[model samples]
Target: MKRLALSALVALGLLAAAPAAWAHTELIGSDPANGASLPQPPTRLTLTFSEPVPAESATVTVTAPDGTAWTVGEVSASGATLAVPVTPGASPAGQYVVSWQVESLDGDFVSGKTTFTLAGAPPAPPAVTTSAAPATSAPPAATSSSVTPTGTAGPVATTSSTAGAVPAEEGGFPVWGWVVGALVVVAAGVALALRLRGRSG
Candidate 1:
């Protein structure tokens, strides 16, 4: 009778411990809860689990609709909650998926995913304006004067403007020839006077 009682107590104790050993950590709730919609993106993602999680073994990834990563740094934990920093500038107005894996106190890793949507479209990118360059005008062509040639060969002669100048007739003797004849007449008169004086003496 005593042996049968001891076996029954041992069976009851094993049955009670089995459930606790088989249980694993599970996600309970999240901030920006699943299927939530917001006008703007959240700065951080918070996840709650059934038990405490370790920061070193927890992993969280936040991805945008276009497959761009939005998570910034390593995962952080506070008891049963985990917080992940998110980059709001990189996240546009679209659906975002959060995938998380955490190591529970029972040495089991639990993973799940949640999604949220942003309501309106993203703001338009800034406009790009280009300035037009100023136009340049070309310089004017140089002017040249034409020269008409005279028939003379070596060099063209120029007229002088001296006082008491004599102008030559079309067909006449030059002034220099008249002056030479007057000089010869005076010389002949002198020679005749000298010869008369000698004869009279």
Candidate 2:
């Protein structure tokens, strides 16, 4: 009985010294730190744990606010760090959830969640209606189509002003009246000359 009790005590001491054998892996740190706000989405993710996890047994998923998966490539583990390449989805511009489940070296599984947000651009303001009037308003009449061009026809008032531009000759000052006055002056001079010639002879 004394020998069995001693063996039991030694086993208990071994269990106590190796506490990690019974415990699952725990998260130690991560890139794009938990609860952090980033200006944009990260290209890859790094998750560190207290225990080394198997790369084949590790699973990592990233989700956008719309619940779309953005994880890409295979999950890989190197030492105590698990690395995953993320395919940054379109508009990764809101709250994001990162979930992980990995198997520790001791065959125990541990799971956890982390949250981060990207500075999202504000929703575009509703498009403005540039038109000042409603669509149902009636269009104006097309009077321009009915009007015809008269190239030579002008206003009578303007024509009359153009015709009176030059001075008019009166009937009392005709060219025939000036000709008859010249003939009368020549006849009186001829008769006076004739009378002088007759006296000389």
Best by TM-score: 1
The TM-score of predicted model 1 comes to 0.57
Candidates' TM-scores?
0.57, 0.57
Put down candidate 1 lDDT per residue, 8-126, tens digits, no spaces.
99999999999988898899999989999988888888999988889889888888888888746778889899888877656567898889898866798889999999888767999
Question: Candidate 2, which segments miss by more than 4 Å at Cα?
Answer: 1-16, 20-23, 65-68, 88-94, 125-169, 173-201
Tell me the number of clashing residue pairs for each predicted model.
0, 0
Error of 2 at 63 (Å): 3.7
- Per-candidate Cα lDDT values, in order, are 0.85, 0.83
* Regions more than 4 Å wrong, model 1: 122-201
Q: Taking the tens digit of each residue's C-alpha lDDT, what string does model 2 give over 61-87?
A: 888998888857788888999999998
| lDDT: worst 10-residue window of model 1 | 145-154
In terms of TM-score, how similar is model 2 to the real structure? 0.57
> Model 1 misses residue 177 by how many Å?
92
